[model samples]
Target chain A: MSNSTAFSRARFAALIACFAATSPALAQPSTVGFDQISAGDTAWMLSSTALVLLMTIPGLALFYAGMVRKKNVLGTALQSFAITALITVLWVVVGYSLAFTPGSAFIGSLDRFLLEGMVYLKSSSQLSVSHIAPTIPESVFVMFQLTFAIITPALITGAFAERMRFGSMMVFMALWSLLVYVPVAHWVWEPGGWLAAMGALDFAGGTVVHINAGAAGLVCAWMLGPRSNFGKDAFLPYNLALTLTGASLLWVGWFGFNAGSAVAADGRAGMAMLVTQVAAATAALVWMAVEWLTRSRVTLLGACSGAVAGLVAITPASGFVNVVGALSIGLAAGLFCFWGATGLKRLLRADDSLDVFGIHGIGGLVGAILTGVFADKAIGGVDSHLGVQALGAFATLIYSGVVSFLILLLIRSTMGLRVTPDQERGGVDLALHSEQII
Target chain B: MVHDDKFPIAAQLFIRLKRSPGRVIDVTWMLENELYALEVLKVARGADAESAELAARYETLLRNRKPGATAAPQQPTAFARTSSFMAEPEPVPAEVGRHYVGSLR
Candidate 1:
C-alpha cells in the first residue's frame, strides 16, 4: 500500500478503537418475563415490512428501470433487487449493531454484531435500551428499517445509471453503508444520538435518509460525469407505463414507510398515512397542471414523478404535520421539484440521470424547511424543535456531500467509476453479465 | 389527480392554446400565466359559459387584426412540430423527419 493508504487504514483502525472504547459498559439486558405483544401492532408491522420491501423490489426498481435507456433496463432492476438482498444480509450481520447499539453520539459499536444478544424475542422497551419503538422487537425493527437503508443507496444509483460498473458500484455501496449511512442513521434515530439529544425531530428520516441520499447522489453524479450522449442526444424513458406503475406503488408503499416509523397501531400512524396520501394526490395534480400549462401535454411520466416528489417531501413531516400542512408541502414540492428537475438541472448541465437530486434532494430540503413551519404541537404532540431540525438537516447536507465526494474520489482513484465506451454502448447487462436479450 | 394517459392530451391542448398561431405566443412561460388567462376568460364571459364561448374567444383572438393585436394562425414554428408521420406504419425516411428513428430500422 502507498503511504497515504497505510495512513488512512491506520486512522480508520484508530477511529474504530476509539468507538469501541467509548461504548457503554452495560451488559446485554436479559429478555425474561416480558408481556405478550399485541396482535394488531404485530400485523401492522408485518404489513409495513412488506410494503417497504415492495418499495425496493418492484417500486424503485421499475421506476429506475423505465427511466434508463432500454439497453440497461434489466441491469438497473438487477442492481436494485441485489441491494435488497445485500442490505438484508448486512443488516443481520453488523448493520443493525452499527446503527442501533447503545453507544456514542456518532455511531454504535459492534456489541450486537451478527445479532449476538437479539436472538430472543423481546420488545425494545423490555430491553430497557435506547428508545426506538419500544413496542417492537429490536430484530423486527432492524429488518423493517433495513428496507429503508437498502433503498436509499439504491436510489443514488439512478443518478449514475447506464455508466457505472457493477463491481465498482457494489464496492462503493458496501463501504458507503458502513461509513456514511450507518453513522447518520445512528445520529438521527438512535436514542442517545447527538441529533436526538439536541432535540431534532425527524419522524421518518428526512435528514438521515432523503437529504443524505440526495446530497451523496449529487456528488456521485458529479464525480462520475455525464453519460456519453448526455448533452448531444435526446435521452428519454423507453416505457412511461412502467414508470407510472412504479410511481403508484411507491405512493402506496410510502404510507407504510412514513407511518410505520411510529412503531405502533396508533392515531399518529393514521395521521401520517392520511397526510402521505393527501400530499401525493396534491403533488400529482400540481405537476400535471404545470406540465399541461408548460408543455401542452400532460404526460404520465410527469404526474408519476410529481407524486413521488410529494411523497418524498412528506416523509419527514408526515407524522408532524396536519392535513393542511401536508397539502401545502405537497403542492410546493410538486412545483419546485418540477422546476428543479427541468429548469435547474438543465442550467447546471449535470447528468443526474433520473432527477435524484431534484426530486429527493430538493424535496427533502423542502420537507425539512416546512417541518419547521408546520410542526404543530397539538398534531405531532412534540414541541416545535425547528432549530434543531434545521441544524440536523444542514449538518447532514454538508457531511454527506463532502464525505460522499471523498468516497467517490477514493473509489475512482482505486477502481475507475465508469465503464469503457464500448461497454456502455453494448449495455451494462451485456458488459457485466456477458448476456444479451437473446 | 389525473392519470398518466391524460398527460399527452393535456400537454397537446396546452401547446395548442399556447402556440395557437395567435399573436406573440411563448409556450415556455410558467403555469401561472395559463391560470391567469383562464381566470380572465372566466371573468370576461360568465363562469358558467360553455366550451363554445371559449372557442369563440380563441378564434377572435387568433383573427384579430388591430395594431399590435395577435396575428392570424400560421405555420408552426420548428419547435412546435413533432416528428412527422409518427402514426404511420412504414419506416420511410421522407415520411418521417430526417432525425426520426424509424430510418434506423
Candidate 2:
C-alpha cells in the first residue's frame, strides 16, 4: 500500500473513535440495541421529565398553597410536596411495572419490578423500549410517566384540603394510585390495552389524569364532607401573587406535559406547542369576558383559572387538532368550566375545595368529547370519533369515581377521614402537621 | 375553724373545703392563676385554720416574697386590669410586620 493511503486511513479511524467517545453507550458495543434510538428524541424526553416534575413541586404546590387560607398555607403546600416524594417511591417500586409493562389489557405486570432490565451494565446490554414510546429508553419513559402519576394524585389533594387526617390522607393516596391510576393508565396508553384498541386517543392523559382524578375528587369531596364553614362563610384566597407565580410555572411546564407526549422533536411536537399557547390565551380571554359580564369585575384569579382550564381542555387534542380546532376547544372549556366551578358547584353541593372537579372534571369531559369532534385526519388524528372519546371518558369517570369512594369509605371506617372540629377550627397546619404559616 | 362571723370570705372558702377538699385546692390554684399571689395571701390570712391550710401557707410565703396590692376578686362581672408598661413585652414573630421592616441590612 502507498504511504499516502495509509495516512488517510489512520485519519479516518481517529475521527470514528472521537465520535464514539461522546456518550457512555457509544463508548462500547453494549448488548442493548442503542443504534436505532434517536439522540434528539432521548434528550428532549429527559428534559421533559424535569419539566413535568417541575409542574408538581413548586408549580402545583404554590398554586394550591396560595389559594388556601393563611393558617392552612403550609399544610396545603406540604401535601403536594409529600405526594411528590411518596409517588416517586411507589413508581420506582411497582407503579412503572403495573402501568407500562406488557401484561393484561387493563393492567400491566410486575415484569420490571424494582426497574430490573432497565440498565445495561455489560457489553451485551440491550435497552428496554416501551412499545407505546418506542423511540425513548424505558427508564426515560418510566420517569416521564411517573411525573404524570405524581401530579394526578397531587391534584386530588386540593379536594379534601385542611380537613383530612394526615395519616389517612397518606394511606388513601397510596391505595388510590395503585388501584385507580395504574389500571386507567395501562388501558389507555398501552398498545394492546382495551381503550387504545377501542381507538380512544388520549394524547397526554385527558381522560386518565384529568377526568379520572376529577371523578375521584368529586367522590372524595362528598365522602370527606365540606370544610367546617362550607357555604356560610367567605373563604378568601391567602395570596394571589403567589398563585400567579405558580400558575406561570405550570403554564410553561405544561408544554412538556402535552408537546412532550409526541415523544419526538418533530413537526408534531411543534404543532402541539403552538396549539397549547393558542388555547390557553383564548380560554383566558373568554373566561375574563364572561366573568366580567356576570360579576362586576375581572380578576387575576379569573385569568389564571381560565388559562388552566384551556390547558386541560387542549391536552387530549394537543396532538390531534389544528389551530382552529384548538381555539374552539379553549372557548368551550372556559365557558363550561366557569359554570362548573360556580353553578354546577352549588348544584352538586360538594365543597371540591380548589375546584378540582369543576376544572379538571368538566374540562376533561369537554376536551375528550371535543377531541372526537375536532380530530381531523388531515391534521394528525384517526377519523373523527366522538363515541370512542365519550366511552373512554365515561369508563375512566366510573372506575375512578367508584374505586376512589370505596377506598375512602374503607379508610374512613378504619382510620377515620377527618380531624376533630377543634383541630379544624384552629387550622390544619398546627392541628395535623403541628405547623403554622407564621 | 367554723367562725363564719369573724371571717366571712375565709368562712365561705372553708365551707367549700368541707364539700370537697380536692375542689378547694383546685379553686386555690384557679385563684392563684386569676389573681396576684400576694393578694390571695392577704385574703387567706383572715381565714379560719381550716381545710385550705396548705393553700393559705403557700399564699403567705408568696405574699411575703412580693408584697403588693390585693388582687381583684374573681367574679361573674368582667375585671379591669392595670396596664403595666414597666414589664417586658414579648418579642414579635419574624413573619409579623415583615413588610414594614423592608429590606433588612
Best by TM-score: 2
What's the residue-level lDDT of A6 in candidate 1?
A: 66
The list of candidate 2 runs beyond 4 A from truth reads A1-31, B1-105
lDDT per residue for candidate 1 within A1-438, as digits (tens), equals: 596576557545544554555664434323432454455765788789889889888999998888776668888888888887777788889998888876886888787788787645335434322246555555567778898899888888888888998888888888888878899998888765677655677888778888898888888888999887566444555566778778888888897899888788889999999999999999989999998898677867788888988998898898899999999999999999898788777776678888888888888888887888888788788765455568888899999889888888898999989999878766787577543332
DockQ of 2: 0.03
For model 2, state the Cα shift of residue A219 in Å.
0.6
Candidate 2 residues B35-89, lDDT tens each? Answer: 5433444444444455346456555544554356444475422222212211222
lDDT of 2 by residue, A237-333 (tens): 6788988888888899999999999998888988888999999989999989998898757878889999999999999999999999999999999
Question: Which pairs clash (backbone N, Cα, C closer than 3 Å) in model 1?
Answer: A296-B11, A296-B12, A296-B15, A297-B11, A298-B7, A298-B11, A299-B7, A300-B4
What is the C-alpha lDDT profile of model 1 across B8-76, one tens digit per residue? Answer: 333343434433332222222212133333333433343233433653454354345346743222523
Candidate 1: RMSD over Cα atoms?
17.8
Top-DockQ candidate index = 2
Native contact fraction of candidate 1?
A: 0.00
Interface RMSD of 1: 17.4
